[model samples]
Target: MENRDTETYPLLTPLNHRQQNQTTTVVFNAESNDISPITGAGEFAREFLVESKKLWYLAGPAMFTSIAQYSLGAVTQVFAGHVGTLQLAAVTVENSVIAGFCLGITVGMGSALETLCGQAFGAGKLDMLGIYMQRSWLILNATALILSLLYIFADPLMKLIGQTKAISEAAGVFALWMIPQLFAYAMNYPIQKFLQSQSKIMAMAWIAGVALVGHTVFSWLLMLHLGWGLAGAAVVLNCSWWFIVVAQVVYVLSGSCGEAWTGFSFKAFQDLWGFVRLSLASAVMMCLEVWYFMALILFAGYLENAEVSVDALSICTNILGWTIMVSFGINAAVSVRVSNELGASHPRAAKFSLVVAVITSFAIGILLSLVLIIFRHQYPMLFSNDPEVRKVVIELTPMLALCIVINNIQPVLSGVAIGAGWQAAVAYVNVACYYLFGIPLGLFFGYALDFGVLGIWSGMLAGTVLQTLVLFIMVYRTDWNNEASLADERIKKWGGA
Candidate 1:
C-alpha cells in the first residue's frame, strides 16, 4: 500500500504543535462528535500491524542473516559437544567471555553504517552510501586492532573472574587465537550493514549460510579428525568469519549492491574524526546493552551457592542471547526501512514503518514467550544434565520468556532511535534504566533477597521494562515530520541529500 494511504488513516489522537514539544502528554479532542484516545491506540495499532507486516516482508531476509550469524556459536558449541564436555565447556566459556563481550560489540558498531546508508539511500544520494561504507570499514578496522590487544589480555582477565587455573588456561588459548578474528569480526559488520542499508539482505544471508557451513566442515576436519582441539576450533571459527566477509565484498564488487554502492572511495576517510565519534558512541551504547547480561552473570557468582547458580544463569543467558540476535536482525532491517522512508521525505511512510516494526516484534515476542513456556521444563537438557542445573533452568524460564517479549519492543525502538539519529537520548535512557535502577536492584534481590538466578534476571527485566516504556514514549512523541527534515539536513551537510 502507498504511504499516502496511511495518512488517510487518522492517528490514534491528533497532536497540536504545542503538545509535541513535551516529552510525554496525552492530547484530547474536545470538539469531536464521538472519538476517544483509547480508540487511537487500536486504530494506530491496526495501521501499525499492516505496516509491520510490510517491514517484516523486507526484514525476513535480514532476519535470516541475523539468525545465521548467531547460530554459528550454537553450531560451534554442538560440534564441540561431540568432542567432550570439557571441549564444550571450553568453547562455551571462551565464547561467553570473549565472543559475547567482544564480537557482539563490534557487530553492533555496524549499526552506524546501517543508519548512514539507510538515510543516504532514502535521500537518493546513492554515491554517499558507498562512501559511508568505506568510512565504517576504516573505523571498524582501527577498532579491531584495539580489540585484538584486549583479546591478548584475556587470560589474566579470566583468571581474575575466579575460573580455575585449567579453565583460564584453556579459555585464554581460545581468546588468544580469537584475537585475529577481531579483524574479521570488525570487517564483517560494516559489510553486513552496507548490504542491509541497501535492502539487499538476501545476498548477505546466502553468503553467511555458506560461511557457516564452511565453518562446520573446518571444525570437523580440524577439531575432530586432526585432534587439533580448541586451537583448531578457534582457527576454523576465524576462517569461517573471514569467508563470509570476503563473500559479501565479492557481491558488492560484482554490482549486487545496486547504485547505492559506487565502488570504494577514499573520500570516506576525510571526515575521520566525525565518523569515529559517531561510530564510537554507537558502539559504546550497543556494547553496554550486550554486556549488561554478562555483568549480571558475573554478579551471580557473588551470590549464594555460587558455582551452580552462575553456570545455570550462563546457560539461560546464552539461550536468550541467541534469540536476541534473531530479533537484532529484524531490528536492523527496521532501522533501515524507517530511516530510508524518512530520508525520502516520506514522513507517513516512515511513521507507518515504525508502527509495523513494533507490532511485528511484539507478536514475535508473544510467540517466543509461548515457546519458552512450553519448553520451560525441557530446554536446559540440551545444554547440561545435572539435575540441579535442570531445576534452576526450569525455575527461571518464566522470566526468560518475559524478557523476550520486552526485548521485542526495546531493541526495535532503539533501532528506531538510531534511524531517527536520537542515540544520545536513548543512551542516557539506557544508563538510567539499566545501570542506575536495574543493576542495583538486581544486587539487592539476588544477594539480599536470596532469589538466586531469577532475582538477578528479575532485576534485568525491571530495567528492560522501564527501558521499553521510555523508548515507546520516545517513539510515540517523535516528531517524525521534523526528523525527516533533520535527516535531509544531515545529508545536505555531507553535500549529499
Candidate 2:
C-alpha cells in the first residue's frame, strides 16, 4: 500500500492533502486527463495514439525516399565498375572518403536544425522554424567551406588511410572533382531537416527520388558511351545533388513551405557561432559511429592476405549501408516527433514516439537479418566473379546478419538522444564504447590472436553490444518531466513560444 501511495503522489503532495481528498483528486485527474501519463509528457500523452499514428503515416514514404537517396551513389559505383577494375576500385575509395565521410558529416550536422525546428513548430512558433532554417544554412556552409579546402589535399589523406599509389591517384582524381557536391550537401541537408521538422519530409523524399533516377541515367551515359570514366561518374552524382537542392529551394519559395521557411538573411550569420558548436557535437557523435567501419576496412588493407578480404567486406558493408538508411529515416522521424512533443510540453507523447521508433527499428532489423541469411550465397556473386572474395564473404554472412540486429537498436536510441538534447552524453558513450573498447579489441583479435577479418569484426560486435546496452539503460531512465523542462529552454533559445 505504501509503494502504491508513493507511486501515486510525490513526497510534497502527501503532506499537503488529506487522504480522502488526495484519493478524490487522483480519481478526478485520471478521468479528466486525455493522454497516457506513463508514456508521454503533458498534453501529448493525452493524444499519444493520434500523434504517434500520424508520425508513422508520414514515416513510410519518407523512409522510402531515404532509401532512394542512399542507393544513388551505389548505382553510380556500379556503373563505374563496368568501366574497368581500376575505375570500380577508384569509385569505392573516393566515395568512402569523400562522398561518404564528408557528406555524412554535413548530414549529421543537420540534427541541430531538426531539434530546434521541431520544437519551434510544435510550440506554434512556425515562423521561428524558418529563422532557424536560415541560420543553419549560414552555420553549416561555413563548415563545408573549411572541409572543401581539406578535400583539395585528398591524395595525402588517401595515402594516410593506406591506399596504394595507384588507388590514391585514382581516388584523388575523383575526390577533387567531387568538392562542389560537398557544398550541395551543406545546402541540401539543412533544407531537408527544416522541412522534416515541419512534417514535410515527403516533399524532399519525392524530389530526391526523381533526382536519383536522373543521376543514374547521367552516370551511365557519361561513364559508358561518353567514356569519361570515374571523373565523369563523380560529375553526374554532383549534378544530382544540385537537382535535389534546386527543387527543394523552389518549394521553399513557392508558398508551399508557408512559415517553415524564412527568407535568407544576414542575421543567420550572427547566430552562426553557437549553432556550429551545437551542430559540431551532434556531428561528432554521428561521425564516430560511421567512421568506425571505414577504419576497420582500411585496417584490412594492411593485412598480408587482405585483397580478397577487403572486397568481400566492401560488398557486405554496402548492403548494410543501404539497409541502415531505413533506420536513419526512422530516426529522423523519431527525433522530430520527440522534440515536437517535448517542446509542446507533452512528455507522454515523447515517450510513446520513442517506443514506436525502437519497436519498428527492431522489427526491421530482424527482417533484414533473415534477408541477409537467405541471400548469403547469392549476394556476393552479384558484385564480382572472384571466387576468393566470395569465399570470404560467405564466412562473414552470419556476422553481418547479427550486425543488422545490433544496429537497429543502437541508431534509433542515438536518435532519441538527439531529440532530448543529450548529444554530449551520447558522444561520450560512443567514444568509450567504439574507440576505447571496440577498436583496440578488434585490432588485438585480428593481429595478436591471428583471427584475421573475423576477429576484427567480433571486436566490433562486442563494442556494439556494449553500446546498445548502455543506450537502453540511458533511455529507460529518462525523466519525462525533466525532458519537458529542456524543451522549454530550447523554445526560448530559438525564439519560439
Output the number of the TM-score-best candidate. 2
C-alpha positional error of residue 471 in candidate 2 after TM-score superposition, expressed in Å? 1.3
True-vs-predicted CA distance for residue 261, candidate 2, Å: 2.2
lDDT of 1: 0.71
Over 240-308, each residue of candidate 2 has an lDDT whose tens digit, in order, gives: 888898999999898887655557765565655566766887788878887787777777766765555
Full-model lDDT for every candidate: 0.71, 0.74
RMSD in order of candidates: 6.9, 7.4
lDDT at position 210, candidate 2? 92
On a 0 to 100 scale, what is the lDDT of residue 492 in model 1?
47
List runs of model 2 lying over 4 Å from the truth.
1-34, 38-52, 494-497
Candidate 1's C-alpha runs over 4 A off are 1-53, 81-86, 217-227, 303-307, 492-497
Q: What is the lDDT of residue 323 in candidate 1?
A: 72
